[model samples]
Target: MSGSSKKPMRRAVVPVSKTLPTDPQDQHSSSEEVDPIFFTPSPSPPSNTPTPDNASALPCDHATGEPHRHPNPTRHPDFWFHDGSIILQVESKLFKIHQTILANHSEVFAGLFDVPPPLPTGTTEGDDMVLEGCRIVVLHGDTEKDFESLLRAVYNPSYFDDTLPPSADVETLLDFISGILHLSTKYLIRNLRQRCINLFTSKFPATFDEYTAKSTPQPSYSSTRSSSHKQERYRSDTLMRALHLAHSCNITTSLPYLYYCTARLSLHRLLKPRPTDVDWQTKSVVLAGRERLRYATLAISYSFLLVFERAPTCAEMRCGFASGPGREWRSIVLGGESGIGSAPTPPTAATSITNAGGVNGISASATAERKSKSSSNRAPNPLRLYTRWPELGVCDRCVEWNKGVHERGRREVWERLPGMFELEGWDELRKAQGS
Candidate 1:
């Protein structure tokens, strides 16, 4: 039945005290303490009958020999179907959903339903319980929000619609997906698990080329209002949560890029992580990887510039000279950290020749103009490929040679990314994903 067409139902609540035994294979065992669900036959008395002064002394169900009710809260507004065969309690919320729907999607639920309730011993209060004339199965470890997301996704086809508008709130989307992924994995719902994995991979692509292709230009960073700062904080927290989720779910392919992004966060931000931030071990790994990235930035990304080796085919004396445009370009790109004492002045139009189409097909004048405009504000992004080699005032041959060297360096860095973050190689990660 459509969720919209279903009216809410009020039912008696039964609090359960007994928790489920820990499943050796359950991923959530280490994180959440789950209680086992008990089932009992419906009580003989009508649910609406006035409670006796000593209601706690009520007799147990004759069939199962289990207590029938403990008043708490009403049924869930959306998921409580009058015809539902089973009642699931997640915290204070109660969902009267179908066993068939759950069994169709989850092997765990199917196996659960296959096992009939134990023969009642009549010794324990919670050995078996009932509510609203249906069996109550309490999910002890799960939160109402997460269980609600799972049911919503199951009952409504359009709940997790992917064709969201461009301006959809990213944080909300991620939260929804994360919650679904968690329960789906626990319940062994393969399709929903795969859907969540696909969404995560799209955001954090497994391949380097895809990652580069989707890379957004880094925004200019500056101090902002309290709201902006809060937004930044939320983004950081979300990133940390995503990293943890990827690890827990064995979404290995996304780890390197996630680690790389974590490495790029400022030291202050890293040091002052949220209380529920990625663990100390993860933080240490990121810090180590950040240092490696810094070394890679200078040693690989700008290797050609560091040595200032002119192309053998270069004819321009200005390109070949150690103190010429190459030195000035190095100073500009490296922020004068290449042993040049002070920040060298930008090359003037007189000193720089206007090549019609230089590096990456960008004209020398345009490159120079862009450089002049943003040079002061732009921070050096090590992973970014330098495409304005013509701004070095070097000849076409030297520019092409440097470009080739830079491209090779970037490819090497991509290959080494997993190692830098202490993760398995991409091939192994891909294999794990398939498995």
Candidate 2:
């Protein structure tokens, strides 16, 4: 490298013999006031100062007999702009980024740059250290990877864009998304923080209608796999991680739906500890919430039993009878062995139905059979929208009435979901999100 083109590495120094001028007029003319780049010997130590022989052994420079200064950190290849005005040292990595760009994006950075940085570790007050022709600032309590992610988002316009298709791998996106969310929040980068919040809420929506839309499986066929299968795989793998992120980031709007998804997880999966496992308090919340969800799902799924007055425009009177649509619908939902479209048995314990009453004058023996069959089936989904009414031998008018009632009950469940997990209502959550 050519010496002439390189910026001088300078350290601030003061003359040993320099003394304050007695006269005010002589102060400005003092020859001791030299440029910061010029090297001057330090003043001699006080008589009481420890000598090398008597002093406790310490790491020191062999040549100077002074404590060793920190080694120069390795420079980041991608982020070191030639025209960068500031250097940020995170751990053992150095990032050269434009101060104006960082300041424009984050108020924290703006205020940080407004005040002078503290003197470097070995230097006294009023001593400044310059590296690569820029002020070197040491950033504490931040990882190199996270700072890189924050810098990428600041420099690259499309870094956090939502241009990726729905089929894009989510785990890969979460890698950068998590880093950006963490650092952005710490740096007070409002736009990047909000972008992260939007991404989370999109997956775990606050509203019932939005949650339903997201939950509705849209199957895309491929040579080897279906889109619905891919989505399910993603959810099963990432739901816990996402829940932990939401809880850590304080994304209140997404917590309700995230907790709901967690509540649906099998007990084995819930209890299995992982590196990112949530706290015991959240685990307790999930357990309590699961019980609440199971009870609500059963009640909502069987709400049709309460419809004593049949639709006047029934296609057939038999459709309302115990041996007809009424009994058939109960069997299908309760997963009776004799019913069509019964769910397959889950590996876990069966969901038990309690406090259920006889429906449409069904006999006691028939009810017992229904209960017996239900005890072997998986839990009912609280968010389930029954669209198989036509296959259940139900008339159009009766189907319409039951569907309306089920939809309303599902909405009610969604509204109460947050409270089950010790969170605020949707309206309050939404307000907090906006704030």
Candidate 3:
């Protein structure tokens, strides 16, 4: 009976009135403003005594009426945050930040917060006290802009989130990363510091070939490919900064690769004293890198010429190649002309081969000469030979042979790169980085 005959009861709804705060001018009535748990007021007025005109005063110091204390001059214009509760005045600029957040990320800050209260005389057991306000701290010696950059990274949620915002520009991105690394090192934030190093390494690879490989074409199966898919190339300054940062931070794994790329810069740029603080590439490293490259270049040049000299005489049936006179390969590189000068040639046919005895001697002499040349030019770069081989008027068989040599030479150079720079092999570097 209850199921069949009972009518459903309807709940009544009540409407409540909403009003603004008592003051009509109060626009922030709906949201609560964050207030500090503790506040330390400024000190009492100073007595009328002649203060020095150049006496430095803290930014937060508001002592009214003295021997006329000058107003504290402003220093950092870019980092002044109106809403920051803890005022960290670095130079002339005041940086308002949350102490708990800073303490969470840095041991130095945590230690600062853990300090016991000052004595009645405004001294902390022989340590100098900061300004009157408990929240106002003074910093000296470090660049204010760098400190600002560190704060931005700490407060910005994008870096900590899974989705990172696109970097506005390479230089800006580099400065941000560098700032983070510098502060992280100072504060002992190992995880954050390592993350900055990783980002830098990913952009500026350790090997010359790896840097080139970043631009290598990727196969796209999609029907609709756009220009946006291509990334902008990093500038030369960015590379220099990466190298400098690597050296400053003791990132040994990135050194050889960075040195290789820097050596590729023109002699003038590489040899010049670093133009600015940011351009921190070490002169000594560049010198060593250049010396190694010079030796490699000379070896390659000699190898190319040796290969050209030892190639067999033309066989007419196999392929069409210029023969007889006026078809020799021209030298295009440094030391290419003097290449075979270092190589010894066998005695001429008229001077030696009088009969069977002379014939065998001539064959052995030629063999010895070729062996000496090959040994002298042991550091070969086959790729350079392949590029210049077309001008040599060689046959298809010879071209293919040179191509194989070029590929082998490239592989050898890459494998020996770490040793050339006097560092551990690539595998060891990667292992140390926990890659």
lDDT of 1: 0.61
Look at candidate 1 and give me any clashing residue pairs. 19-35, 19-36, 20-35, 20-36
| Candidate 2, 1-435: lDDT as tens digits | 687865443332322112211222222223434222122122223344332213221122323534323343567999888888776777667687888899999766775566354333333322233445555565655788989888888888887664445544557657657878866765667798888777766777877778777767676665454445223344545887887676545566788888877777666677777776765667788888877776675555445643333576776765555333444445544554332222221211112223133443345446756554554334335776655565545567877877777788888888888887788677766654442
Candidate number of the best TM-score? 2
- Residues 1-435 of candidate 3: C-alpha lDDT, one tens digit per residue: 667665332111211111111111221121323221121222322433222223223322322223212234353455445444455655445565667788888756665565444333232222222332334454533466768767766776466343233554556557667766766655545667777776666666665465445544555667465322354554556667776666554455676666666655555565555554233335565656555654554355334333343235445442332331012211212124223222233222122322312246667656545545544433222223234455545576666655565455555666666666566788766554331
Model 2 weakest lDDT span, ten residues long: 343-352
What's the ranking of the predictions by TM-score, best on top? 2, 1, 3
**Tens digit of per-residue lDDT, candidate 1, span 1-435:** 788865443222332211211232332223344444333333334445433222222223433444434434346889988778776766656788988899999866775566343332222123334444445555645788989988988887677684334344547557768778777766767788788787776677778787676563344456453222122223677778778787766677888888887777666788895886887778999888877776675677666665566688988777765344445444545344432111223433333343421443346656645554444333334566665565566788887887888788877888888898887788877765542
RMSDs, each prediction?
A: 12.5, 15.2, 20.0
Q: Which scores higher on TM-score, 1 or 2?
A: 2
Each prediction's TM-score versus the true structure: 0.65, 0.68, 0.52
Q: Judged by lDDT relative to the true structure, which candidate is superior, 1 or 3?
A: 1
- Give the distance in Å from residue 27's predicted Cα in candidate 3 to where it truly belongs: 55
